[model samples]
Structures are given as structure tokens and as C-alpha cells.
Target: MPPHHVAWWRPLFLIALMPIGVLGNLEGDALNAFRQSLIDSNNVLESWDPTLVNPCTWYHVTCNVQNSVVRVDLGKAGLSGTLVPQLGLLSNLQYLELYSNDLSGVIPVELGNLTALASLDLYQNNLNGTIPDSLGQLSNLRFLRLNDNSFTGNIPVSLSTITGLQELYLSRNNFTGQAPDFYNLSKLENL
Candidate 1:
């Protein structure tokens, strides 16, 4: 065999499968981390066919050529469970909506790690616990809705740091204290 010839037994024989391998890694991580919640909540991925070879082709799922999950929305879904911080592993996630679900858990501080996030809606859920100050790190956030939940404690002033925020909905939560200064939110259009 030539030095450049593909070897059947060699794992490196299929260099083209690298991207598929990456997709598998991502899918495996997502499945492992949110296994229980995903299985319990149809709202998050009601039409998703996990049996498919690639998750990118599933309903409500979008991906780049690399087959990475960029959005996950299950608004008004009948889901119930805590949000696993491992969700932050989707480095490319931009939109995440789980509004009006039966979800109950702390808003993961790790979510603030999603620097590319543009929209986040978890309204009307049964989620309890204080808003994480780490959320202020979503510099690209344009929409934020966390209304009507059982969350308790003072609103995180750090959240006011999102410079691109347009809509801010915190109505009917257990939040207390005055609004944070709006200087960091220069492009804010609605609240």
C-alpha cells in the first residue's frame, strides 16, 4: 500500500469524518447532561427525532456546516425539570426559549457564559431561586423575559450591564428593590 493510501483498520483513514465525530461529541454531551429533562419534557423538543443520525436536521434545530446546535426553544412546552448547567456546552447557542413550561430550577449562572445569546425567555415557569449575577455577562442579549415565576431575592444589578438589551420583562416575579441604573444599556428600546 502507498503511504498516502487509506488504511481500513486505521482510525485516521477517514479524515473526512472529523466533523461527524465533532457532531457526535456535541450530541453525546447534550444528551448525557440533559437526558432526564429532555425525556420528560416534550415542549423543548416535541418533534425532535433523536433517532436521526444528526440532531441538526431535527425540528426547531439549526446548525452550521459543522452541525452544531445554535437554537433551542420549547416555549409553552409542558416540560418540568431543572436546567442543567451543561447546556452551556453549546458554545454556539443564540436563542433559548422555554416559556410557560412547568420547569422548576435555578437559572444556571453558567448560562451567562453564552456570549452569543441574543434571546432568552423562561417566563411563566415554576423556576425558583435567585437570578444569577453571571447573567449580566450576556453582552449580545437583545431580549430577556423571566416573568411570572417563583424566583426569590433581589434582582441582580449586574444584569443591567447588557449593552444591547431591547426588551426586559421581569413582571410578576418575586423580585424586590429598585431598578438598576440604565447607563450600560445604551441601545435599550423596551423594558
Candidate 2:
């Protein structure tokens, strides 16, 4: 290839690499925010270095080949404290497994932003407050286990629209009023 051709490809490669760098930083910041909010008595999150380009290398965190955060496997790590809203910034997140922890406080409404989410496992925690209506936006979601929490309020009616949902676990919560009809949830096997 000519010198000019090589130079042209260099700029294009740099442009394509820019977003990955930005995404790495954004995801790193988001995960760091979670670290800041938690009480990691077991030092499970001690490897989460804020200066790192991305959290993909951190323990309990998983990322896709594109370096985008896809899952957070912090279940039963003895972590306590509230969830951070910055976690919603992980646009490509799929499975969020924060279950079986001592995490307290209301679930952040921002969690609804994880549109690509397929499995949301926040069960076995002390989360309170109403489930965010935004969670209904997860059309791709199949497994939603919010059971065993202190969450109150009628399930969001929008959830009934999730035809792809297979397992719905809202039991063991303090939800009041008649359960919203899941008659439309054709794929639901567990309620």
C-alpha cells in the first residue's frame, strides 16, 4: 500500500478505537460508583481499580468482546449498601446478579435503563420501594426475580406487556392490592 493509503487507514482505525476508549472509561466509572456505595467486608471488590481503563478485568464483573459491561456477578459477595444510579449507564448490560446480598435501600429507578437486560436477579436482598415503571421497558427480559425483597406497591402494569418473560418472581414482597393480571404473559412459567 502507498504511504497515503496507510495514513488514511490509520485515521479510520483511530476513529473506530475512540468509542471503545470512551466506553471503557464510562463503564469503569459506573462500576467504581458501585464500589463506592458498597461495604465490601470480604474485599471482593478490592481489585476494582478506578484508574483502569475498563472494569472487564475486575473480579465479579463481565464484559463483552467490545469491552462493554454485559454482566455484574456480585451475588452473595457479602456486600451491603445501596445500589448506585450510575449503574444504569451500562447500556449493554445483560445479566445483573446482585441477589443474595445484604444490599439495602430502594432499588434505583435508573435500573430501567438497562434495555438489553435479559436476566435481572435482585432477589434475596433488602431492597425496598416500588419497582420502577422503566423496568417494563425491558422487552428482551426473560427472567426477572425480584422476589424476597421488601418492595411494596402493585407490580407495574407495564410488566404485563413483557410477552417474552418466562419466570416472574414477585412473591415474598410487601406488594399490596390485587396482582396485576399477567394473563398476557404467555411465556411465563413461574409467577
Candidate 3:
């Protein structure tokens, strides 16, 4: 065999020898972590196979043209689990819909890393803990609904920084302090 041919095939051989999950996509891993944490009695997440290259083909997951996860629509899926912090790894994620489930625990502060996020819906769950102040980092967020949960403490003042926020729902919670003034949220249409 020619030296040039050997070099070309060597890389392919090495890749083939790698373990099954070695080349798994980061986004897939993140979503798998979330799946692992959940108790899906209805098998709604049955298609969430971690062995897949990317999570784009998974049920309830949507990907953009670039094959990066852009949306996760699992609302009212009978899922009960704490939201995993690893979900923050999806940098291109624009929508996260996990509402009306039995999810508990605090919203992972790492979710603030999703700078592209446009909506975050976690309403009517059993979630507690103060909303992470880091959520203010989502400059592109337009809809945020955390109503009907057990969230306590004062609303994060940092939330006022999201100038593009159109809908903000903190109703039916146990917020004890006065709501922050969203002077910068001129586009807000809902409270």
C-alpha cells in the first residue's frame, strides 16, 4: 500500500476502534443526563437513546439546520425529576418547555448559560428554591413562566435586566418580597 493511502486509512481505523459512546455528541450526553434523572412512567422519552450521535432525532427534541438542539418540548409528559444542570451545555437551545410535571428542586443556575434562550416554561410543577439570579444573563429571553410552583424568596432583581422579556409569570408562588421594578423591561406585556 502507498504511504499516502496508509495515512488516510489509519485515521479511519482508529476512529472505528473507538468505543461506542466515545464519539457521542455533547448535546446528546446532556439530554441523556436529564433522561437519567427523570421518572418517565409514560415512556414519553423512550426514544431518548444516548447511543445516538446527536439528540436531534430523539423524541420531543428539535434541532436547527446545524443539527444543534434548539428546542425541548416535554411539557406535561408525566416526567418527574430535577432539571439537570448539564442541560446548560446546549448553547444553541432557544426553548425549554418542561411545565406541568412533577419536577422538583431548584432551577439549575447553569441554565443561564443558554444565551440564546427565548422561552423558559416550568409552570405548575412542584419546584422550590429561589429563581436563580443568573437567569438574568439570558438577554434573548422573551417568555418566562414559573407560576404555580413553590418558589419562595424575593424575585431576583437581576430579572429586570432582560429588556426583551415580554411575558413574566411568577404567580401562585410564595414570593414574600415586593416585586422588583422592571424599569428596563419596556417590552413586558405580562406580569
Output the better candidate (2/3) by TM-score.
2
lDDT of each: 0.77, 0.91, 0.93
Pairs of residues at least 3 apart in sequence or in different chains that clash in candidate 1: none
Q: Which candidate is the best by lDDT?
A: 3
Candidate 1 residue-pair clash tally: 0
Ten-residue region with minimum lDDT total, candidate 2? 1-10
RMSD of each: 3.5, 4.1, 3.6
Cα lDDT tens digits, model 1, 34-92, are: 64565453444544555556567666567767677778766765777788887777777
List TM-score per model, in order.
0.81, 0.89, 0.89
Each candidate's clash count: 0, 0, 0
Between candidates 1 and 2, the lDDT winner: 2
Query: Model 1 lDDT vs. the true structure?
Result: 0.77
Candidate 3 least-lDDT 10 residues: 17-26
In model 2, which runs have C-alpha deviations exceeding 4 angstroms? Answer: 1-18
The per-residue C-alpha lDDT of model 2 at residue 55 equals 88
